[model samples]
Target: MKTLILTTAALALSAGAALAESHAQTVRLGTEGAYPPYNFLNDAGEVDGFEREVGDELCARAELTCEWVTNDWDSIIPNLVSGNYDTILAGMSITDERDEVIDFTQNYYPPAASAYAAPSEDVDLTGGVVSAQATTIQAGHVADSGAALLEFATPDEAVAAVRNGEADAIFADKDFLVPIVEASGGELVFVGDDVPLGGGLGVGLRESDGALRDTLDAAIQSMKDDGSLNELIVKWFGEDAQTFE
Candidate 1:
């Protein structure tokens, strides 16, 4: 009698957990609300920017209820794996190393170039001390290129290294650096060739979450087919920014 009672309780708990998961169909879309043009907190202190626009449209088209979630870049992937959020819609590039740990939706934004930025046009890139956001592809690139790689927790801090003369230059996304260089009024300038990195930007998901991945993949394909993806990229990063077909 006790064995039967225990089995029934187990079944009840399994059903309850399943019910909770179904109720959780209200997806949580995670992003680092610090990368501007891609994502950032607006003056209203709420998540805003390009990925925000894209994610909202995706949820609407997929007919899924989703809420925006802000997380730091370093912990972003691990949190998705741990179920803190259902998806990561940050401007994360699709790469093999990342793919080994998580599945990705099809590319929404094409691969962007990484470039060096400095206070002057004549900064040494190959052998100079350079800064990049910690744990990013740019950081790896700088480390591999014989440049002294100084990494920071955030993009702003990486740029601050160059501004404060702690580093000779900073390497980051061209689209990101272009705005800063222009806004710097000659305070900062681009140096060296623009290096293309990664495959392209895609939505990050847990490897076991196949159903959720399919839903978002379909939504991305729909956006690409309708030209809306290209429109959004151009809207945020300008006409020169990489866009999907």
Candidate 2:
């Protein structure tokens, strides 16, 4: 009877472990709902963009179901730390500062930033215009050029400010800004060569979650190998602009 009871207890522990592992498979994804061509809300109030497509592919490849959560850009990292979500699919750059707080998956995209100005405006961004997002690395590249820096609450606001003549130009990731420019009916134009925005977008997870991070990184690699990443970029930003390498 003692032997039988011990065997039953072992089976029960094994079953519990299996259940726990199964429960740990889902990956919760987070994104900022405003940055278009990356992750933004559409007319139907659905969150659809480049990052969303990538997130879907990642989940499929990892054989995990993803639950996407949308929040303001500023709140993304905070919420990730606070357990609001497990991963950030937002176009979040993998900067060193961010790495100190969260573990990032292998980079899924490349560094690409640019400045956009009103088409009719004669702003010479070549002279260096400070970026409005001060924490962004681009701010250092153009901080001292006296090129008229404008502050904005969000990327959309920055683009609108330029469109309405409130600001001469706005700096943003090419993947995010290019779509806005093309959709703006020739109102905005690229001001200069694309700048290297340190760190491209990646899946963000807590530093403790090494296993989950590995799974996401593998999924991203699979997507790149199968051409899904390139296809999505071209679908959103045209063939010429799909430069993710």
Candidate 3:
């Protein structure tokens, strides 16, 4: 998982506090439509990807009407709190610090490893200008790795920095980076060990939305038991991705 950082945002939002809501009739799944395999907009300019498929299935299993909402990653949680969406299915990782601001259903995607990519394998991954999407766990990791962290608003921007020689390498989820490296055709190569981060990816909910949490959690559990979730993981991320039994 090595997603964006969590330690910073929890201080601003309280997780697990008492609040009330009527039973949900419809739920909005919020996502950052930029991260591929996990999530990305399709050629039709619509929400389309693994999470979209999974979210739609979860909605069907829960007997709730679900709609997709695209949001900037940095403000996703805030918008959820503001009621712009009912649930966050944006490839968010479950973690202690984030759990302080919002509740998470059980993980759908198992913990994934993060990695670095550069124009050459000889690139210095531990130092120099390393790029990462801001607020991602990779960025935090880079900050602590003694590298000069060059953060971008989106993952594409971070990767672009590496391509443009603005950065020595780009650090991000290996699952997310694998395709980029494969398609680079010698333009880029894997540069370092893969680092596992985050507990796993899950649907996020406000602390008060226990009922909705239960509904989505049950749907996820059912999918896991029947191997549907694993099937989806394979379809989107290839069989090499971490998946539940």
Compared with the true structure, the alpha-carbon lDDT of candidate 3 equals: 0.83
Against the unseen true structure, what C-alpha lDDT does each candidate score? 0.85, 0.70, 0.83
lDDT of 1 by residue, 1-245 (tens): 64664454345444434543676667899999998888999999999999999999887766677899999999999999999998998889999999999999887789989899999888878788999998889999999999889999999999999999999999998877888999998999889889999988899999997766666776776677668989998999987777764
Per-residue lDDT, model 2, residue 108, is 81
Error of 3 at 42 (Å): 1.0
Candidate 3: Cα lDDT at 215: 68
User: Residue 171 error for model 3, in Å?
Assistant: 0.7
Candidate 2 C-alpha lDDT tens digits along 1-245: 64664454345444434443687755678888777777888898878988888888777656676788887776778889999888988777788888999999878876656555455556776553434554454444456456666655577776677767666677777766766777888877777567776677678899987767766676666566557787887787677764545
Please give the ranking of all candidate structures by TM-score, highest first, separated by commas. Answer: 1, 3, 2
Provide the global lDDT of candidate 2 against the true structure. Answer: 0.70
lDDT of 3 by residue, 1-245 (tens): 11221221121112211111233455788999999978999999999889999999887766676789999988888898889998988878888878998889889889989999999888877768899998877888899999999999899999999999999999999988999999989898988788988998999999998867866776777677668999999998986777885
Name the candidate, 1 or 2, with the larger TM-score value: 1
What does each candidate score in C-alpha RMSD?
10.0, 9.0, 7.9
Candidate 2: give the clashing pairs: none
In every candidate, how many clashes are there? 0, 0, 5
